[model samples]
Target chain A: MKSHTYTLRVEFGDCDPAQIVWFPNFFRWVDAASRHFFVQCGLPDWKTTERERGILGTPLADTQAKFLRPASYGDVLQIESHVSEWRRRSFVMKHQIRRADVVLVEITEVRVFARRKGDGSDPHAIESVAVPEDWRAMCE
Target chain B: MKSHTYTLRVEFGDCDPAQIVWFPNFFRWVDAASRHFFVQCGLPDWKTTERERGILGTPLADTQAKFLRPASYGDVLQIESHVSEWRRRSFVMKHQIRRADVVLVEITEVRVFARRKGDGSDPHAIESVAVPEDWRAMCE
Candidate 1:
């Protein structure tokens, strides 16, 4: 599968009081990278997808990450992301965050295409849908 | 081990375009819950620990999380956290985020007590330290 790279610069606010990139901020960047991968693959934005197909967005089902090294503000980082596997209702995305040649973190996420549940029980509820063939083809 | 619960109200800014809580924000809340667990165990703040014992903070080595449900702004959530296991130089924390009686997310984190590496190779480098016996005692 083709991979997409999303580059970002660490900001002071991204770091915690310990002067290291707060772990949660890494997730934020990875989330952006996930979306960037879809965009680079010629997929429409979530809003457009929702309007066309009722797919609101891809929401994470599960995620695992290993933090190998700490990153601080002023560092330029690149996140290389790709869809590693496509399941019936979910897919796995693999992401490697690197500062130059050093890999700082690696993450694997299982995400599903979700749409709002219109059953009127809970307005905020969402349900996952099967992987769309067209979307998977574009990503591949 | 004793467990601690941290409560917070989800804000509008924490949600993404889907009007659900952005996944990364869950990590942020879990991180806070981790620290709050330590504080509830009578451990000093990171600054004090660093000043007195050269322990900067517990930095995550690895983490895994499962997102069970989506939450939106105006929801009041509680994260219950506790150390599930302690290794020689690392420990595992388990967190469950809930809205009322509904569990929204579950996370497991392997973290280490880290200190700045003063050997002068990389200023931002950090090294893990063995779990402090006194601190572990306090937590237990």
Candidate 2:
């Protein structure tokens, strides 16, 4: 799988009073990474798909994470993200956070189909729309 | 609506390449707030339920957010969370991230039932075990 790399510097707002990276901050990085990767790779702008679909396009069905080490303030970290599985009804992505030579965190976020066009009642609808061919091609 | 507060410090890990709070980090902060509010108010532990139920306890069903101001590293942000509504098998919660008096971001997270504890396969089950009586009283 082709993993995309995104890097950013830690600012004062990303840490805790302990001066280490706050745990919630990790999800933020993954979110940004996903958005950037999709946008860069050209996939109908995943961010705005919700409006087009008339429903919330992104919904997390499940996620599991492990904290390998503490990320401190002022550190430059890299986030590597890739599709762990791209299924017909849903998709799973894995993200890794690292600094220099060390890995700080690993997270798996599973997203499911929610509110289809015009209605929010569908329970995990297998999207009738196929995953964009160009998007899949980029993963290749 | 009564709101609960959760205080967190920013870590370098939560920032963008520009050292601003990454978007996904907002989810983390709101989640922390949810966990803290539930636990502090004596609600059942989500982790424990997941173990007993063999199902993922909490999943984000829908989330919409607006970024007001950027949060920087080392800033202490307070997250205020409150239940917007409690309906059959679903609920809405509102969150605001603030640095002292300034609002950094606002979000609405809607969560629904993933599976039933008795049988994890019945994804159709949509029910909340009634907010504990004590929790209702506390909220009242």
Candidate 3:
């Protein structure tokens, strides 16, 4: 599959008192990278998807990450994201965060396309939908 | 081992365009819960640890999280955190986030006590140290 790269600069606020990027910030960046991948793949934004297709967004089911090296503020990082696997109702996204040639963190997430539950139950409830063929074709 | 519960109110900014809590914020909360657990266990703050014992902080080596349910703004959430296992140099911290009686997310992190490399290498470099017996005793 084709991969997309998202570049970002680590801000001072992103770092913990220990002077290294707080681990949670890595998740935030990867989440952004995941969205950027879809955008770069010619998929519409979540707002557009919701209006046109009732697809609210891709929500994470699970995620795993390995922090190889610590990154500090003032560092420039690149996150390379791609879909590694696809299921009926879920897909796996792999992201590698790198500083130059060195990998700082590696992350994988299982995510599902979700929409509002239409069963007249809880209005805020959401349910996953099957992988959209068009979306998959664009990503792949 | 004893567990600690940290409570916080979800704010509007934590939500995404779908009006649900963005997944990364769950990680941020759990990381705070991890620190709160240590504080409640009678362990000194990271600054004190670094000054007194050369122990900087617990840095994550790896982590996994499962998102069970989605939460939104105005929800009051509780994160329960504890150390689940201890290795020679690394320990596992587990966290569960709940809204009322419903579990929203579960997280497990493998972390190590880190300290600055004293040798004349990169000043920003850190190395893992063996789990401190006193700190482990305090937590247990």
lDDT, each prediction: 0.93, 0.65, 0.91
Candidate 1 colliding pairs: none
Encode model 3's per-residue lDDT on B1-140: one tens digit a residue: 79999999999999988888988888888878988999999999999998988888899999999998889898999999999999999999999999999999999999999998865244359989999999899999
Of the candidates shown, which would achieve the greatest DockQ relative to the real structure? Answer: 1
- The model with the greatest lDDT is 1
Evaluate model 1: give its TM-score. 0.97
Superposed Cα deviation of residue A92, candidate 2 (Å): 1.4
Q: Rank the candidates by TM-score, best first.
A: 1, 3, 2
- Tell me, by TM-score, which candidate is best: 1
Candidate 3 stretches greater than 4 Å from native: A119-124, B119-123
Q: Kindly report the fnat of each predicted structure, to 2 decimals.
A: 0.82, 0.11, 0.68
For candidate 1, lDDT tens digit of each residue in A1-140? Answer: 88999999999999988888999999999999999999999999998998898898899999999999999989999999999999999999999999999999999999999987885255378899989999899999
DockQ score, prediction 1: 0.80
lDDT of 1 by residue, B9-124 (tens): 99999998888999999999999999999999999999999899888899999999999999999999999999999899999999999999999999999999998887535537
TM-score of 3: 0.96
What's the true lDDT of residue B70 in model 1?
91
**TM-scores for all candidates?**
0.97, 0.48, 0.96
Scored by TM against the true chain B, the candidates give 0.96, 0.78, 0.95
* Poorest lDDT segment (10 consecutive residues) of candidate 2 chain B: B122-131
Using DockQ as the measure, name the better of candidate 1 and candidate 2.
1
